[model samples]
Target: MPFVQEALDGIEFARGDPNSTWGSVRAAMGHPEPFTLKYVAIGNEDCWKPHYRENYLKFYAAIRKAYPDIKMISNCDGSNAQLDHPADMYDFHIYQNANTVFSMANTFDRTSRVGPKAFVSEYAVTGDDAGRGSLLAALAEAAFLIGLEKNSDIVEMASYAPLFVNTNDRRWNPDAIVFDSSQAYGTPSYWMQHFFSDSNGATLLKSTLQANSSNSLEASAILFQNPMDKGNYMRIKVVNFGSSPVDLKIVIDGFDRKLLDSSGSKTVLSSTNVKDENSFANPEKVVAQVSPVKSLVEKTGTNMDLVLLPHSLTCFDVLMKSDITQITADDDSHVSSM
Candidate 1:
């Protein structure tokens, strides 16, 4: 009974009728306790449907009374029904080209009101395998992710929709992550997710680049303090959109170079020629490779400069010095406690 109660505590169920006898069946299914469901979506992409408004209202009223605390989300676009019902979260879908994705980020940043935080539940570039699954798309996805991280406080939650695509039974053109039936492989966009999720840091530091051309690269540095330990580190993600390699002069105004001793740099290059992706046969064909640190120079009162490859993703980790005076002072304070 305790296990059943725990399972039902936060479970959201989908059904048409609230007074329907199915509630008992849900409880009977190894969970005799009623689940404290919070949000329930009426339907997916209901704006295009014919009977969406009527059916949605029916379900909305019934579910509202059945569980008054449950928050309802109507899956409708900007329409009369959405304005009328006014659910907790309004679902919206956006499928656009690479350029459009960039524009959307700027729009979100400027927009004053998009009541019910906009959830970019579905979005991706479209076209044949050449365009949809191209390196350009991957780069666009990375840029969009940067915008998302910058605006996480406003955006509630976002997911790359239609996650899987079977090359055999193809339905969608481009997906953030894709795979085939026989072999499951990730697209270049997939790498963007892995890189972002794995390397997201706690503090976002301001970064800018001085370049001669508009194609030159720039990025914001993210500082992450290890949650489990006191280990502190930094990730410098450089987005180079230039047609030619730009010589980058890196500088951390506040941090010291002793921190970068153990941390190494990794590059994810999606060169125009290297757009080939992984298949069942060739899994590691187009993955990111560790580029040797060409030249690293550290000095006082100067920026660190290095030549970055043209049109590439470069990440650098700068490890924090454990023996810094402040760190040592804190350690001394803890030692006194012992």
Candidate 2:
């Protein structure tokens, strides 16, 4: 394979182009080291079109023959109707209101587990409910992401859309990061991603909540290593979608009280108003505010009760101080003197 450094060279990648681009990888890199190319998607949102399958077959045949290890994604969705061609995965794009997207976290729960895995290439909260990536939008999207994290087995990958918007040029609104002139600011949608940036290969936990407001809440727990010290810690993330504050009892089914940190910091994304957006005059109007949770005196040993604000996203990063019980799942008696 040859490395393609330009569009003309890439154009040769078509199925039968005389100067095919697939054969340039070796020459471009000056070596035969395999490129870590695992996934490639066809045209987006072109499903159900007559020419889609036709165009897809050409690339599919050429790529499959040239690189048999590469996994191909079809533009058509076989989640509902089976496509005539073979594909390793399907592209599923979605755009809806904040409230609707909140419920969309469970979108793939009913999909048949036997078919191609789902690749949510594009999704975001738009329309009147989302004014240039407002807090309401981020809260809903955070919940939806939690659902994706829970069902990651079938959901191969997912991503947010409108990643950038140039204030100088009026084009797409509700972007994750907005920039213009000499300054750049991240929307709530952008800050919300920080909470999940380290979950890529981290170990996910089975954390459960028992409260009357549980239905309006979405959460996922994971044990990720700290980059500075490489120490493992339990990070619990939650998104509250209701109007009233929730008194959540943070219960870990597999963690011991002795290993828990003396106290942790809570990062929350909320504002005086749900529809608040960042402006040049007030860039920090809507951002993830970090505050120490050292005053957590309301708990029953390993069971700690934290109050969750309504329409907000929160994460508690508790450090692992020392070795504790290695039991898999049990509510250990809280040792106050840890």
Candidate 3:
């Protein structure tokens, strides 16, 4: 209660202060405008604190009265339990093994549809499976992201934690990007994020897989628009967690052979072993490799070969020449060429 105003002052900027204000702090330091302040989290991983709820409400009320437009995040998993105080969003963090995190891809599939949207701010496959940024951990995280993309209505925000780890420090290892005093390089987790980044603001398509294939294969399709040429594309991301390759055949309902171009790309993140990680000396050992895929489609929505490697995260970006006015699939629109 004693730290309410100060916390609000630091979070949303105190309303009645001139000498000690966020705007003035930015200007006095020689910035054109203040930093864009919209979201604020009460605390991180403070769900078990007895005074968390008490302190949270005090801060919430003060900030709400001053800045009614800002969204507040609560440090609790509303999916597992109910919240006493209201929040704009709820914080859900997970640090599990590769198999555990991969299976949690559908964690939000059955969550409550009402109340605040979720903010998966901290999540990663840690411990033995995530030893120094392994390919297995990246594939598991990619599967989880596909589930998030599918359930974007309930899950508003998501990100992997421990983005950087200095080799000398060596405390929070197996990060997305690793660095030392002089050199820095990305792990497989970093490359996996690049695939998901392209899907931002892109329209998620209505696509599904066979029931039997649900165990080891996680996939999602999106109508991604290229920002460069303003062209449309169909992106299919698949994560195969099994030990064997998946001879996958993509069937998009809607036959538009003329809509596709002669170009396509396949970005894969895999390694000889699922436990392979990148070290400072051998940084590129477990990174993703992008290679041009053969144009297997001729006209419209036809079956495309999306062979996924064993224990890999694969992204297939196919360029489309026209915008999709209708995404409905007719009898003739079935693309099963396998």
lDDT of 1 by residue, 1-338 (tens): 34333323333333323333555565556555555556777778875689787777777676666667766777775312225555666665766776666445444455334455555566665554235366655665566666655555444456675677877776765654556555577766666565565333245554456655534454645666545555665666766655577777665555555555444456665555525555567655556666644235244222556566666667765556553334322111111000
- In angstroms, how far off is 153's CA in candidate 2? 1.6
| Candidate 2: worst-modelled 10 consecutive residues by lDDT | 329-338
Q: Which residues of candidate 1, in runs, are more than 4 Å off?
A: 1-39, 46-87, 113-115, 129-132, 176-182, 199-201, 214-218, 225-230, 249-262, 272-274, 291-306, 322-338
Candidate 2 Cα errors over 4 Å, as ranges? 1-36, 78-84, 295-298, 322-338
Who wins the lDDT comparison? 3
CA shift of 263, model 2, Å: 2.8
TM-score of 2: 0.83
In model 3, what lDDT does residue 184 have?
91
Residue 328 shift from truth in candidate 3, angstroms: 6.9
Which stretches in model 3 have alpha-carbon errors above 4 Å?
12-22, 80-82, 211-213, 253-258, 324-338
Residue 311 of candidate 3: its Cα lDDT?
A: 93
Better of 1 and 3 by lDDT: 3
lDDT value, residue 1 of candidate 1: 35
| Global lDDT of model 1 | 0.55
**Against the hidden reference, what TM-scores do the models get?**
0.69, 0.83, 0.89
- Model 2 clashing residue pairs (backbone): 1-24, 1-25, 1-26, 2-23, 2-24, 2-25, 3-24, 3-25, 301-334
Most accurate candidate by TM-score: 3
